[model samples]
Target: ERLALQALDRADRLGVAGYVLGIARELTGDFAGSMRCYEAALKLLPNHGAVAGDLGRLAFRMDMPEIAAKFFMHYLQARPGDLEGVNNLACALRDLNRCEDAIEVLRPAINEHPAQPLLWNTLGTIMCSLGDGVTAVTFFDETLRLAPEFGKAYHNRAYAKIDLGDVEGALTDCELAISVAESAEDLATMKFGRATILLALGRVAEGWKEYEGRFSADLLEAPRFTIEGERWSPGMDLASKSLMICAEQGLGDEVMFANMLPDVIEALGPQGKLSIAVERRLVPLFQRSFPQITVTPHRTVSYEGRVYRGAPEIEDWSAIDLWTPMGTLLETFRPTVASFPNRLNFLVADPARVEHWRRELENAPTGPKVGLLWKSLKLNGERARQFSPFMLWRPVFETPGVTFVNLQYGDCSEEIALAREEFGVDIWQPPGIDLKQDLDDVAALCCAMDLIVGFSNATTNLGGACGAPIWMLTGASSWTRLGAQTYPWYPQTRCFITSDYNDWDPTMQKVGVALKARFPMA
Candidate 1:
């Protein structure tokens, strides 16, 4: 790549040379340099700059979706109604967190070019991202109708079907995708998709086996598990060796996976040592809960002499004999539904903190204190399904002898005020607590509450882990497994789901009635 860049530099053909240099730089992973070279090439070629498409692709790679969208627009202007260009622009918009805009960008193109499978596929992808999986399935079906041989469409359609409670359809799509996959990466993706659907359907043994495909060729850009040691598998006896369970994904996932810590500890016995890698913010909470195991933050310092934010950085890598991702624990510990070691008090909150919150709640009106969360921090497509407007929770708010407390994280002061004005109710925001940062306090707060009612987010997870009485108002589809009214992981966290996608009216009324019965005034 460096030799190619040097050769392109020496060619000195001005416009074309600069464009070739940009491509060479991008190949060598120097995205900033590539952008600069592309900009120089664009200046040299002006109105006839053929590098617009390349620039758009480069910007999209760099996560500058707005800039990518602008470049795609320019490229589309030169060649209007280009199917690939339209799809690229919509994808850029989707990455920018503008799903509606992405849909709008492709909808006109789809009508104009009715036979284009790529347009329908792109629209389906965007709708899936926005959590409208039912609608996304229709779009994906249209794509398949146009291009039956498209393996990517099959892979995407599988996800849409999973969200729509059609596991059989999803499995069929996965089989179709696997059969038509042209590359090793595509094959791995189909396998992983099949694994997720299998897990959701309670086929744990096959799902766990298929899940090994997550680390397949050319799929993960970085090491899936950062711990540089032998990965612990089933049959590897941990009773006499040191084992590390490295955290994967988000905070909620970490907490959910930690439910199996007791099982791991029991498996290891008295002689073995157990260590865990979790998010930095969760260190205190995990430490307080599990005093037997060593807890460390999972952050990494990259090879480029720059710290990679949110990547797990193993502090002491020498002592651990075997290491595995926390998610992988489910394969061995919970291979069957009956094997799930359900617990009431797996996570212990600080008693001091619990008392502190208890005293604060004492001054409030004497009633059933409830915590509520309406929105997630990041409003991705699946999360959009979990949302319930403040107005929709009116029945619960109007219930007498109930003191509502705000547990929704992020800047929701405006929402609180709006609820007060519109519903003639006030949700008391607790003083001196950052809901996002303070998991320990959040756990204590959950303990302090009489009940916690919210969507499927971090707060609900925290409460569920703490054994607090929590009623989760969920959407039709959830990775947390919502086929049952009660989750196997957390016995206290009862789930009340909407009958159809985004229809909260019936669910809300059920919750209101439940609340009245649970907290009837004498």
Candidate 2:
């Protein structure tokens, strides 16, 4: 502690007060403290180009991209020839969701600093984020030309190649990235990327093994559970010991993995206690679904040995096994489509709410009830592949005898208005339906619809769970492995896939044809 204070004093004397403070606060996980320190430093010496650039970086980390853009622009103005500052500004603009502005900002910088590897890498990342993989690949290639050993450039370029349907190119880059990775985390990232690409390419056997790399950290940290005299298998003599199955991921993962519980229990037989750790939101659902097993929320779980002080504690169990609901598990046990579960009677809204919806539908006599899902809850690398609100079901709206109902959340007002003006149809939006308050509202709404059509998202899941006939649209990469017409999880769902990357027109046309065939008037 004394040595740390001496270093802080030295930093203050060296005119690195803000930088030192930011580092200190960040180490303690106080992001707000780091932001304030960085902001103060910038205010003190506004013309310090390096400090301004650092401030921009800190602002971006705080999720204040607009503020970060200002700082970056100031940094660029101070040091007009600074390629790094220019690239940082472009990234800030991109984070602010001004992709065109970001692209325009980088053009002059690229012209001036043509051979700067970092600048080219930044440009590639921005273009990739904006859904222009073709241009991104070009920029990544330029980056590789200047810095051949840059593993990150290779990894990102592989992603762009995958987006553009260049699978072989992506695989080659992945292999190169894996070879250069120094840390376990870096190795895991490259392995995961390669595994994802392999999964996309329908090479499941190799992909599944690489995918197991995800458990490294957890396996290292947690104590392994072993029974004294029992051997674990599908069916073994396990009359005395308990088997713990811990949930290792998200809510959707929990739902997906819950399907595997019956098999786990059947394997363990009636004597062994199958204990599971799951998220709080899933407690009721899991309890209702699997009454036989012992389900504990993660918050309630405890640890022992070198007990980390202030950490929540729970009982130390005899035998623990971690399970994630990855696609590989489904592929292994239920390889055939026939093994898929059909018990999809979701608990929708009350009868009164259904009656209210029925009355509203009855008021509109001429058109078939159509459900619209313009958004999904999950946001990450895969989100770009999910359908945007502006893109889906345009052809379906163009078809006659179809009435579109809005089931989307988050920034959908603009899309709703545009849809109203373009289609000249009053898009039905229900009032006061909070997702948290009414978890099954979408399923309830699907209960009233003649046919449900949307992107492969939560709404699609809801429709499928409600046993509604659904026309689900997916990206080419996703549909290649999952299949073109059917999903094992959702029995009522039929998939329509894009033939090319970022091209939804053909898929939309297929959906239109299916709609017409299924509903003659539509």
Candidate 3:
């Protein structure tokens, strides 16, 4: 790369040299530098297809889909015969939620280059995005048939199979994906994908260990922990040791992984001590729940399009005997289904708030006080498909003898209003609670409800952790369920696993039936 840059001293192939330098910068994780070099290359040679394609990919990775799509379109215009250009353009279109446009873009390429595995793979991905898993599976099958060594197709097939209610098939595909993967980057990501499948298949022992691949440097994503200490591992001496467990992942995942905290505490013994860094909002809750363990809020900051999590509160890293990402503890403690304890109220909410919510529920004239959370606030990409529409929650709202409490945090006034206008049901908003900001009080409010029903989110996870009866409407083969009908992490859990997102109406109907049976009408 340095030689290519020096070649610019001769003023020969200046655009190509700049492009080479861009690639070199990209390889070294200097995306901003890469962007500058690529832009310079494109500015020098307006018709450079390779530079355009690379710029499009980088833009896509940086979450600039509009700019990416523009570049991809330019690249395709310049190099119409390139199967890669067609595939990339289609991918960008799909990211923009222009699936039909993506299909139109891909169809000509697949027709022109019928044997190209990537074209077929792109088609499969687009179909998967459309919630057409059956069709997506077929496309993936064709992609794999054309090129058996193609790793990404196998990984994608696993994802499609998951939605098709084929956990066993997904697991098989995950294994094949790992075996066929060529790059360290691909292998790391494939292993992480396999972990989800293994856990979904109830193979917790292997799943927990493989799950660490998420933090692998080679993987083309960032959820990196900035811990400054000797990382704890399985078989580490915990007795009389001072350990720090820094939380990882999203709020729900942090809460779910926290099932192992009590085990860590007990293993540490009375002489030993523990400290934890959780999400800032969760500091109070974690401190109250685990009085024996010191709790501090974790710091998360995004820099140059990368997320870094750290526990900065402990200035003296040397003071700690060992530190580990909280998720890693699962490998040591929860090896199998039987290894998980029937833990209850592991996250103790504020007693005063709990009593206050209980009194509020008591004042309600009749029927069960059912707390409801339908969808996650962060509905990005495929996640938007995982949740049913508010209109589809009709049967759930139709349930008799139930006063629905709106536990959904984000601006759910639209849903609340719809329930009143369409279903003649008033989903009551609990007073004095800013549902999103007041997560500490949310736990207590969850505790007060007779039953909490929702798709898996931070609040439902909190409700489950606090020992509330949570009927979690989860996806089929959700790894968090650990391949069980019951959520092993929480003591009080009743799962309603939806096999297909396209048809969650029947599942919601079942939930209504179950709800009616649990708390029959007057």
Candidate of highest TM-score: 3
Position 429, candidate 1: lDDT: 81
What lDDT does the true structure give each of the candidates? 0.78, 0.63, 0.87
lDDT of 2 by residue, 170-236 (tens): 8899889888876665676787788767766656556655555554542212223221223233323
Error of 1 at 336 (Å): 1.8
* Best of the candidates, lDDT: 3
Instruction: Mark the 10 consecutive residues where model 2 has the least summed lDDT.
Output: 304-313
How many collisions per candidate? 8, 2, 0
Cα-based lDDT at residue 34, candidate 3: 88
Off by over 4 Å in 3: 4-16, 43-47, 62-67, 77-82, 96-98, 359-366
Better of 1 and 2 by lDDT: 1
TM-score (all chains, Cα) for each model: 0.89, 0.77, 0.92
Q: What's the lDDT for candidate 2?
A: 0.63
Query: TM-score rank, highest first?
Result: 3, 1, 2
Worst 10 residues of 3 by lDDT: 377-386
Candidate 3 or 1, higher lDDT: 3
**Model 1 stretches with alpha carbons more than 4 Å out:** 11-18, 21-50, 58-64, 95-97, 129-132, 182-185, 220-224, 300-316, 482-485
User: Which residue runs does candidate 2 get wrong by more than 4 Å?
Assistant: 1-4, 7-48, 55-74, 182-186, 214-251, 275-283, 294-367, 377-382, 388-392, 479-485
